[model samples]
Target chain A: MAVRVQREAFDIGAEIDRLRAGRTSVGAVASFMGVMRDFNDGSGVQSMVLEHYPGMTERALESIVAEAGERWPLIDTLVVHRVGELRPSDPIVLVVTLSAHREAALAACAFIMDFLKTRAPFWKKERTPAGERWVEARASDDRAADRWQEGDGA
Target chain B: METAHGSVRVLYFARLREAFGTSGETMDLAPGLCTVADLRERLALRGGVWAEELAGSRVVRFAVNQTLCPPAHALSAGDEIAVFPPVTGG
Candidate 1:
């Protein structure tokens, strides 16, 4: 498993190739990418600044990936989250899960993103027409993360 | 940078950073400040924005030494405390 939080942009295709370089057991690859949007809360956003607690951000991400591993049987997992300034259409995150079957890879990829949305320490500040404002935490995200609980009847 | 003998570092992030008007501070350990909740209360006692942002009624979260921790987690000298609102990143 690999978890990375960096300010640099990443190429998803290259990342997948690098991770699955010599893994012959991999049969399924499920991936999810989050992109920056131009509008939010009814305002036109021009740019965004991602903020995080240096030491804690990486730790939180690693823990999330670790939790994903505990819940799924996998060949490997990669989580790459971007920080710093970003524009609309910029890729924000990428999660890839490789497994022997499609079921494990697909579910684990979704699970990792759900967990990252809630558990991770990163925050976003969007520059809109009016002014720069911090993005509000959504209740929907909490609901999304909630379904992953052990006894959560999805 | 200077190090204090009996102090805990408190960090503010995101909205809390703007609301509280500072990024971080070195607070000396106090007699009654024993847990994360206690430290929060003491900071909230500053009233106004500090109280509003640090208030328990708000959706606040805490981390002790980079670990997300509960309010009851004990505080210690040299510990790093972070206070922030709920995360919104994807």
Candidate 2:
């Protein structure tokens, strides 16, 4: 498993390929990408700056990936989360999981992203027409992460 | 006991950083300030904006030594404490 928290943009295809390199046991590859948007909270967002705690951000991602590994029979995983200034359509994060079958790969992919949304230390400050304002944590995101704890993975 | 030796590096992030006017500082642990909540309460006791931002009704999060923790988490010398708003990342 690899977790990269960097300011530079990441190539999704390359990351997935790296996980599958010389691994024939992997039968499934599931991935998810989150991108920056131009509009939020009924306003036009001009840009956004992603802020994160230096050492803690990496530890959070690694811990989330480790949890996913325990929940599924994952062969390999890659998580790339971008920090710094971003504009519309810029990719913000990527999560990919490999497994012997689709079930584990797909569930683990969703689980990783869901947990990352709430647990990761990064915060977003969006520059809108009004002014630069920090985005508030959404209750929906908490609910999304909490659902995984209810029962077996769907 | 060398209570004077109990100093920690405290960090503030995002909005907290902006409001506090500094990113971080080294704090000499006050007497009896043994928990994260106690530290916050002590800071809040500073009054004015310090009280408004940290001591008010607003909710903030805490992390001890780079890992998230509850308010009651124990504090020690050399610990790295972080205070910030809730996380909004994916």
Candidate 3:
């Protein structure tokens, strides 16, 4: 498992290939990438700045990935989140490479992203036409995290 | 004829500090406020801008001991409770 918080953009394909480098049991690889958008809550966003609680952010991601490990027969996992300023269409975050059987890889990939959306300790401030405003958590995100409580892989 | 007691220190970060104008503070909490929600009500009573910012059902985030926590999280003297707006960072 790998979790990195940096401003550098990540290459999903490269990371996935490295993860599977000598592993044969891995039959699947799944991933997700989150990018900065130009609109939020009906506001025309120009850019965004992300901030996090340093030590706490890494710990939170570690815990989330550990939970995924417990639920799936994952061979490897990676979570890369960016901080500082980013413009629209910039890759802000990436969770790539879950190795396992095809089914386990896909399910674990979705589960990691869903858990991160609600549990991660990062925040974004968007520069919009009005001004820089903090984005609020969506009800949809809350619901996404909620499903895991009942659907723990059994 | 009284012993000295330290005040409770509450930390603020992100939008909460920007709105409140103070990054952190140690305040002598009034008697009987011993949980996250209780502290919020007492702090909200500070009046003026604070009353407007923290008043009524506004969504705010809480962290106790560096972990995301709910308002129901219990507090004791000297515990570190951080208040901020909901996280949106990548």
Clash pairs, model 3 backbone? A122-B89, A123-B88, A123-B89, A124-B88, A124-B89
Highest TM-score against the true fold, candidate: 2
C-alpha positional error of residue A32 in candidate 2 after TM-score superposition, expressed in Å = 0.6
Candidate closer to the true structure by DockQ (higher is better), 1 or 2: 2
Candidate 3 global CA lDDT score: 0.81
What is the per-residue lDDT of model 3 for residues B1-90, given as tens digits with 9 covering 90 to 100?
A: 333345677877677777889989886755557678888888899987677767778887888777888888877667777777766654
lDDT of 3 by residue, A7-101 (tens): 87778778778878898887788888898888878779999888787777898899989998988888899999998889999988888655657
TM-score of each: 0.94, 0.95, 0.88
The DockQ scores of all candidates, in the order shown, are: 0.77, 0.86, 0.58
Candidate 1: segments with Cα more than 4 A from true spot: A150-154, B1-5
**Mind giving the per-residue lDDT tens digits that candidate 1 earns over A1-154?**
8889899999999999998999999999999999999999998999999998888988998998888888889899999999999999999999999999999999999998998888889999999999999999999998988877869554
Query: Which 10 successive residues of model 2 chain B have the least lDDT summed?
Result: B1-10
DockQ of 3: 0.58
In model 1, the clashing pairs are none
- Relative to the true structure, how large is the alpha-carbon lDDT of every model? 0.90, 0.92, 0.81
Best-to-worst order by lDDT is 2, 1, 3
